[model samples]
Target: MPRTILILNGHPDPSGKGLCHALGEAYAEGARTAGHEVRRLDVASLDFDFLRSQAAFESEAPPPTIIAAQADVLWANHLVVIFPLWLGDMPAMLKAFFEQVLRPGFAFSYRPRGFPVMHLKGRSARIIVTMGMPALVYRWYYQAHGLKNLARNVLGFVGFAPVRDTIVGSVATRGRESIGRVLEKVRELGRRAV
Candidate 1:
């Protein structure tokens, strides 16, 4: 059956057109071509403080819009995350979205013993990350695949199954052929995504 996908674009500069856009464009087109319904949530366009006020988190109220976004997260069958890796990890807003949207009672449940448990089962995800650093150096020095653990452990803890991680490495300055190669890979990933 065709699935419904939620595409989360985490890049601040939508028009910059690098590996980040490569991830977003690929998955959006790929899911569409595969006959899946796609809904996009671009982080850069959303307004609101990335930090929920201390009072809001502690007591009476959090933003209603955040509640709404959580509802959307629940609706998606396939979650596709596209982003650029900055300072060895996800952009702040992207991280903040998880902090805000993936709430305690929504994305997961906790065992009475105090650990969080997965709840959003029956769904799957793909996280595609673009990095400016070379893959090897990033992995060796900076632990590039830590994002994979975020997707696999954190998001997976929220119940997404079979979470796939794609890293488009070495995105700093590139020659024409190299740029073309990355774009080609993006297209290929899109075509293969189902």
Candidate 2:
């Protein structure tokens, strides 16, 4: 069945020629070829305050861009996020974007007891991350900390299930051939609407 997909380019680079951006485009292309509806959000192009004060969090009204992003999230059956890892975490802007868009009430709401009910259920997600170190080293040595944080903590917390990831590492050392192979793999994933 054809599904609605949202591709979020989280690289914080508006020029859109880096590995992360390329991967995002490849995925979008594949998804479109597979007859899925696709929408894209490049974080760098979004005009919004990245700094979220406590008051902002408490407020019901978020910035206009954030509201729009939340609507996108609600619209998508699947989400694909492509970003480069810097210093073992997502870029500050990407992290801040998540903080703003996945706000309370939109992503989740508290219960009288126990965990909050997840409002964004019935959605799945895939995370494609590029990094400087080898992929295995990042997975084994660093315990895939960043992926775990996003897949388990953030996305899962919001009720995005079956969150999977692809870690493309040694990006700085990889040649065009290797990068092209990675892009193809990402495209295949998109083709399946994964």
Candidate 3:
């Protein structure tokens, strides 16, 4: 059966000639070609307050758009993220989105004894991360993926297992061909995804 795929463009830097956006487009185009319904949410273009103020969290009066975004996440069978690795992590806006949207009752829960509970599962996820540094050096030096552990580990704890990741290393120095190669790989992944 056909599936619904949600794409999140987390790059805060807006560039008409950016390689990251191209990667996202390539993945979306490939997913569409493979007969999956695709929905995209570009964080940079969204007009919502990113700050998690006390009123924003406790007042039950979040912006209408945030409410809508939560709905979209729940409706998808696949989740894909296209973003740059700024300072070894996602943009602050995207991270803030997680803080706001991935609320306790929504994305996860807790056991009676203070154990963890998961609410999102039965859906696959993919993250296409671009970095200015080489993956090996970054991994060795940083001793980490330079990515969000929550998206894969925390979310994976609940039900989003097998969260696939695509790392576009050396973005700051990659050539046109290198970028194309990464895009091609992403496209192939999208095509083969169930």
Best by TM-score: 2
Distance (Å) between predicted and true CA of 88, model 2?
Answer: 0.5
TM-score of model 3 (CA atoms): 0.88
In candidate 2 the C-alpha lDDT for residue 151 amounts to 95
Backbone N/Cα/C clashes per model: 0, 0, 0
Write one digit per residue (lDDT tens) for candidate 3, span 31-123. Answer: 889988888887777667766575565445556777788888899988887778777777788877766777667777767787577788788
How do all the candidates rank in terms of TM-score, highest first?
A: 2, 3, 1
- lDDT per residue, candidate 1, 160-189, as tens digits? 888887777767767778877776676665
Query: What are the RMSD figures for all models against the true structure?
Result: 2.6, 1.1, 2.3
* Shift in Å, residue 60, candidate 3: 3.1
List candidate 2 segments past 4 Å from native: none
Q: For residues 65-169, what per-residue lDDT tens digits would candidate 2 score against the true structure?
A: 888998999999999998999899999999999988887778988789999889989999999999999999999999989889999889999999999999998
Provide the overall lDDT of each model, using Cα atoms, as 2-decimal numbers.
0.73, 0.91, 0.75
Highest lDDT among the candidates is held by which one? Answer: 2
Worst 10 residues of 2 by lDDT: 51-60
For model 2, what is the alpha-carbon lDDT of residue 194?
93
